[model samples]
Target: MALWKHLVQAASAITLAAAFTSVASAQETVNIGYTGPLSGGAALYGKNTLVGLEMAAKEINEAGGFEVGGKKYKFNIVALDDKYSPSEAAVNAKRLKSQNNTPMVFTPHSGGAFAIQAFNEQDNFILGAYTSVPNMTERGNKLTLRIPPSFAGYVQPFINVEMKAFGKKLAMAGGDHDYAKAWAQLFGPAWKQAGGEIVAENPMSYNKDTDFYSGVSRVLAANPDVLFVGGASEPTALVAKQARELGFKGGFVVMDQAKLDEMAAVVGGMDMLEGSVGVLPLIYDKRPGTEAFIAKFKKLYDRNPGTEASYHYSTLNAVSEAMKLAGTVSDPKAIHAKLSEAYGKLPPERNPARITSVDDRGGTNANIVVGMVKNGKVETIEAASLGQ
Candidate 1:
């Protein structure tokens, strides 16, 4: 009787082990690629973008992963640092496609996105572009997906507000990077068209130069009513602080690359950011799903999620949904076609940016919330009315 009881216990243990193995065998991994500035002046921005993708992947895995083509799949993000260089980004894309066979590669900067666009179709991977540059989708790349709405929508509203509050004269003191340069180019002509004068144009290297006093002072010498300055949040804050130190008490038209909330953190508070206009930071978003997403993000990372983090998180979730709808995890064309449908299918909680549709050119349409620093507080001056 003792021998029989021992044999029965051994049999039960074997059955449990087999069940665990079976469950493990049923799950498969799907690789996704992220190439951006993991180190350098733009490191924080890149890290924020990566965390968003990682957070979404984590949530999807915790929910037992999504199913596609009759197989259960979990996500594995293969990340590489490009140091914010377009050439390095191109190299990383080749490696990701050759080694991991990733169906998609996300890049935060416009330069890197354009670099990838040159060859993403040939390599059969989708370019998950995070840039708001209108040309990102306009060039007709089949597998390209522009996560954020075009920055073109901000020009008119910015002109309306700044030209009214400040004066007709504007000075350009933004970063010299490709993204900032594009912004300055757009703003300069638009500001002129709106009956404003470009008193000065001084582009600074916001990434490399810590001392923006020279550039800021140069722009201030023009005695402009509004200073157009922005880059990454840190350096942009420095530029604004120095302008204030120099007694330039006028309004500011901040480029969208530099977040107002992050700039405020660096320069002390919202009081320092009075009369600034830019994208509405996710923390100030009163949309229905934004609060819950922020709460979840804070619980996970122990800090507030910015527009970069929230947008990427929601975009990644939409991509995963697109995969399921396309019925395959590896086909870029199918997933691209289904993206619009998939975006509408997401539960509101999973979509903090509130993406509504994907157009034929692969650009997303959403409520581009714009905010302004008015009387020491960030207020939503425009929402849903623009970027539709």
Candidate 2:
């Protein structure tokens, strides 16, 4: 009787162990790849993007993961640093696709996006491009998703605001990166079209050069009323600071890549950023979605979130929702097709930028808010008012 009782207990224990194993195996992991400048001058920018992606992934997993085709799956971000190099981005994409079978890859900078775009459709992975450059989505890569609305709309408004405040003699002093080059090219002609004159153009390496005295001096020598400057936020701030030190008392046309608030942090205060125009600082946005996102992000990161964090965070959440709507986690094409529906499902609290929909070519659409520093405060310049 004692032997029979012991055998019954052992069988019950074995059954329980098998049940635990089955439960563990039920939820699978889906790898999502990210390749950006995680270890270079733009490390902060890259880290912000990664933080947003990871934060959203953690939230999804904590809520029991998303389900598709009657199976549950959680996201696992497979992040690799490309040091802001386009060639390295391409290599990372190949590795992510071959090894992890990631259905999507996110790249923050336009250079990396363009490089990956060259082969992303071929690799069957969606490109979560975080660039504002209009051409990124215009190329028509079927699997690409432009996270931020195009900077194209900003050109007219930017020229209008800066030209109104400062004289029309524009001097180019932005970074030499692909993104900045594109912005300069776009702005130069537009500045001319808007009845502005191009006085001087000087492109310097924002990442490599520390003392921009020579470059800024050259641009300042042109006696232009407005300086076109941008790169990553920190370096851009340094350039602006150096220009101020050189006695440049003109307005600035800042590119959308560098956040004005972040630059203010580096340059002491908004006093230094006075007369500068760029993308509106996220903190200034009074939308309920923006406020909720900032609160949640601050709780997690212990600091204010910028456009980099907000945009990437919303993009990741939207992508996850797309997977659920498409009812497949592995098919990039299907997922891309469902993005519009996915964005619609995002609640107000989840969609910080309040992106309503994506265009047919893949770019996300929303009102572009332009901010200008006046009296040491960021004042909103509605895109509608600017005729964007």
Candidate 3:
């Protein structure tokens, strides 16, 4: 009888150990790879984007993980800094796919998005682009998606106002990347049609550019009524600051890639960014959806979420919900299709209002409200005022 008791106790211990192991294995982790500029001039853009991505992951994991394949999988990100370089992004994408086995990878710019797109189809992964370039979805890559309204839409309204209020002479300066090149090229025809003359076009490598004094001086000498401050918030702010110091104060036509509020802090005065207009800030949008996101984001990060990161947040939430609907986290193709189907059907609990708009190419056709810096903040302008 004593020997029988010993055997039964050993069997009970084995059962308990097996139960613990089963529970631990049930909560599997799903990692998504993200590539962007985390330590360069565009670090703020990349970091803010990552902040939203991570916040989404944390919220999903906190809600007992995303259900897939009859098991619960926690979402996480294996992010790498690509410095907004296509070459680095390609290499990073390859590594993330082969080594990390991530179903999706996030890139914040057109260059990186294109690099990943060149081969992501073959590698079988989704390219989540937090980009402002229209070409991102123009090619019809089934796996690629644009995050926000393209830089393509920002020019018509901007030039409409600048040509009338500022003057007819305009000069453009930006990096030679795909998005910057697209911005400069797309704005020219609009400017010309609106009775504005393109006085000069100066393109530099943001990766190599340390000082804009030389470019700003030369461009200012051309007697431009508006200097197009291009690229992300940091470089755009830098251009605004340098231009102000160089005494070019007619007007600053900021690009949509950067956040105006962030740039306002850098340039440090309404006098500097006065008459400057770009994308509308979420704080200014005041939509119930946007306001709620702002409140939730502020509660966690103690600050307002910017445009780029907010797109990232929407993408993450949408992707996870799609995965749950797809019922297979490993299949990118299924998840991508399900993403299109589940776009607006996301549960209200999972930031339902974020499904604001989705174009045919899976890109978000978010609003393109250009506002000038009034009273040290971005004040929205009526599109009708610009004849847009």
Candidate 4:
């Protein structure tokens, strides 16, 4: 009886080991690379977006690793902290490509996106960029999958609204980075077209311009109707806070980088955000499945997902669906084609709340919906997209 008992225990161990090996064998893993500011001043934006991407991966794995054309794949996200530096983004991209053979990479920063885009096609990996710079897809890079609407999309709703409702004369102040320059270019012309004038343009270095009070105070001196404050989430909030403390009562532009929740936390609620206009995140956009996504995201990350997370989630969803259709995750051309195809299939009813279209250039066209902050919450106002 003792020998029989020992044999049974041995058999059980063997069976468990076989099961584990089989589970591993059944699912094939594909590592997706992400390089962004996982630490430093922009950690909130980068980490939250990483959470959204991982959340998508989790859901896909839970649903039994999608099978396409008899090929099964389990996706894993590989992220590295770039400290929000473009050179670091390139270095990490090389590491991810060499070490992990990542089929695709997501970089939320425009400067980093540019770095990735420069060689991604030659490297034969798809570039999943969250930057809203209008010219990203215009470069005609097939591997470039720009997931968010261009800054041009924010013009009609954010700038135009602030122009008419708040005041006609507007002032712009932000980091003199390429992304901010693109935004200023787009918004400046849009406001000009709307019969408004840009009173002052204040450009400062992102890291050096920590004391926004000094610069913003000068911009406020212009006494414009609205101030388009640009930068990462924390800096934008700081600028807004400084503007408020300086007794400047007017509208603000959140520059697509700042999350309302984080901004509220920093500036003490939505009282300072009244008449502010900017990207409406999932928590406020209420796009189809937005609330569901928000609930799931909150449950996983224990915080409200802002635009960074929501758009990353949407793009990650698009990428997954594209891979499933393309039947191969490593083929750049196939994945690129399927991305646009998947976008066509995903609608509001199909859980496509923010995205409206994906053009051939791989540029996404999401409808313009600006959020107005009221008492620490957001109120959304839909507006037409660029050229609409």
Candidate 5:
């Protein structure tokens, strides 16, 4: 009897240990990757995006992470600084895919996003973020997910509104970056479509360019009724300031990169940004859902968020929603399908005013809001009426 009792106790202990091990093994973690220029001229852009991403992740985790297959797993973020280099972005993307096995990556800029998209197309993972270039999604890459309205979609309204107000002749200036080139190419065709003419188009190299005298001189000589500055904060601001100094007193159309605060800082104040038009909506206007996000962002970072930052934040939320819908994050195919479904099912409160649904190619049908920089802030000039 003593021996039998000892054997029974041993069996009980073994069964309990096995059950505990199974439970622990069932708990998994979902890792997400973020790649961008954490250090460089675009560092601020990357930093703001990171802040929003982190905020979203924290909130999700605090809410008991995410549920999948009746099991709960915490979400983790693995961020790498690509320093705004395409080659570095490719390398980081490969690492995330092979080494870390990350399910999705959030890229804020065009160059980095493009590089990752190239690899993700083959790997069957998800690449989500805001990139204005339509080609990023137009090529039918099954993995690429864009958050913003394409430059082609957003620029038309801008042209109609500005051309009617300022005249037909237009001058275009942009950073010599890949994204700016893409924007320039798109704008040229779109401007012509809208009964406008591009009198001159010039490209300026970024980082190595601090002086816009030569480019501004050429633009001023063209004497366009309106000027379009395409690039990130600093370069666009420099071009705008120099154009004004050179006595080209005309309305300006800033591109997606020129956020309200950065433009104001570059032009010395809100007065300089006054009358400048851009593609993003006024996010700080204390709208119902937006006010909470803006308030949280400011409370955490003590600064207003930009388009890039907001897009990144939304991407995080969308990812969480996708995971919940799919009930698993390990399978990229399942997650991708779930993302499409979740986007359609998203409540009005969770959806952005622009994007209605995620298309088959993972592209969101997001509309654009045309706004003017006034009093050092972006104010909505017109809500984009799609197909107009």
Candidate 6:
């Protein structure tokens, strides 16, 4: 009888331990990964994106976190610095998937975003981003979602205005970066489609070299009526300054990467930006919903929100809403499906005017606004113009 009692006690202890372990495992926290350039030329972009994500996480946690299948799971962010390198992004993606068990990743830059997109496909992880690459969502990659308007969508309005103002004879001067190259590839076809002629195309390497006199001279020799300056703030500004200095009085169409302040500062104030058109929607414009976001972002960061920051914030909101709607964080596939549905079903108060719907491939049907630099700031020249 003593031996039987001892055996029963051991079995009871094992059962209790197993039950406790199961409960603990079921209450695991939900982890979300954010990958971007935190220590390179694009560090500002990554930093701003992180701020947005942090804000979203704080808001969600304040609301008692996300409820999933009758259980409450707190949202946690695991940020990995890829330094804007494709290889590093790939490695970071794998780590987030395997070790962190992250079902979704938010990427900011184009190269890193595309790298993660490729990895997500192979690993069956859901990848979302504010990066504006149309091809990222073109093929119906169910696991991929884009938060911002694609480069193609954004560029169309600028192209339309430029073609109408300056008769064809286009010259492309864009950075050699992935995003810029992608823009260049689309520019030729897009310009041709608008009945414009491409006189010459020149790609310049930026971030390392600042002297764009040579590149500007080359584009000048083409004698095009207008030049397309594609790349981030610094390079675009340098190109514009150098082109103007070289006595090229032609019109300039800056890409989305060229922020108004940076362009004006680089090219000797708003005079250079005057009459120049760009693709990025102006953030500080007097839009109905944007004012609240701008005010809140300024209060938190103590600075005006740029395109990178605003887009990142919007992406985070989209993700959080999807999680809430799905009511579970276990299956990434289900979460992705929920995201698509939530994106469309979001109430007007939760939805931004820029974004309308998500297609089957997770491409956002957002309308891109056209703006021109006037008086040292970006002015919305076209309202609700879907350049398509």
- Alpha-carbon TM-score of each model against the true structure: 0.89, 0.89, 0.83, 0.86, 0.87, 0.86
**Residue 54 displacement (Å), model 5:** 1.3
- lDDT of all predictions, in order shown? 0.89, 0.89, 0.78, 0.79, 0.74, 0.74
Per-residue alpha-carbon lDDT of model 4 for 1-388, expressed as tens digits?
9999999999999999999988767457888999999889778778867877888788878888777778677889999999999999999998999899888989988889988878888888988888778888889888888888777767777766676568788888877877777787787888888888889889766645667877887888889889988776667888888888899888887787666666777777888888787777567656557777877877876877766777777777777788888888778789888887776666453343467668888888766677877655688777764233
Measured over all alpha carbons after superposition, the RMSD of each candidate to the real structure, in angstroms, is 3.7, 2.8, 3.5, 4.2, 3.5, 4.7
lDDT for 217 (candidate 1)? 88
Give a tens-digit lDDT track for model 6, residues 133-216.
778787656798887767676667777777767678889988888777878888778888888888888889875678888888
Tell me the tens digit of each residue's lDDT in model 1 across 1-30: 999999999999999999997876644778
Off by over 4 Å in 1: 1-27, 383-388
Kindly report which residue stretches of model 5 are placed more than 4 angstroms away from their true locations once superposed.
1-26, 281-285, 347-354, 374-377, 385-387
* Clashing residue pair totals per candidate (backbone < 3 A): 0, 0, 0, 0, 0, 1
**Which window of ten consecutive residues has the lowest lDDT sum in model 1?**
379-388
TM-score of candidate 6 relative to the true fold: 0.86
User: What range of 10 consecutive residues in model 2 has the weakest lDDT sum?
Assistant: 21-30
Best by TM-score: 2
Better of 3 and 6 by TM-score: 6
Return the TM-score for candidate 3, rounded to 2 decimals.
0.83
Q: Write the per-residue lDDT of candidate 5 for residues 1-388, one digit (tens) a residue.
A: 9999999999999999999988675456677888888997778778877876787788778888777788777778888999978789878877887866788877877777877777786876788756767777877777778776566666777777678667888888878877777778877788888788889988887547989899889977988988888676777888888888888767787777666566777667867656677765446444555566776777887877666666666667777788888777777777877766666665533443335567776677654567766556677654445334
In model 5, state the lDDT of residue 136. 78
Model 4, residue 363: what's the lDDT? 87
Deviating ranges (above 4 Å) for candidate 4: 1-27, 347-353, 374-377, 385-388
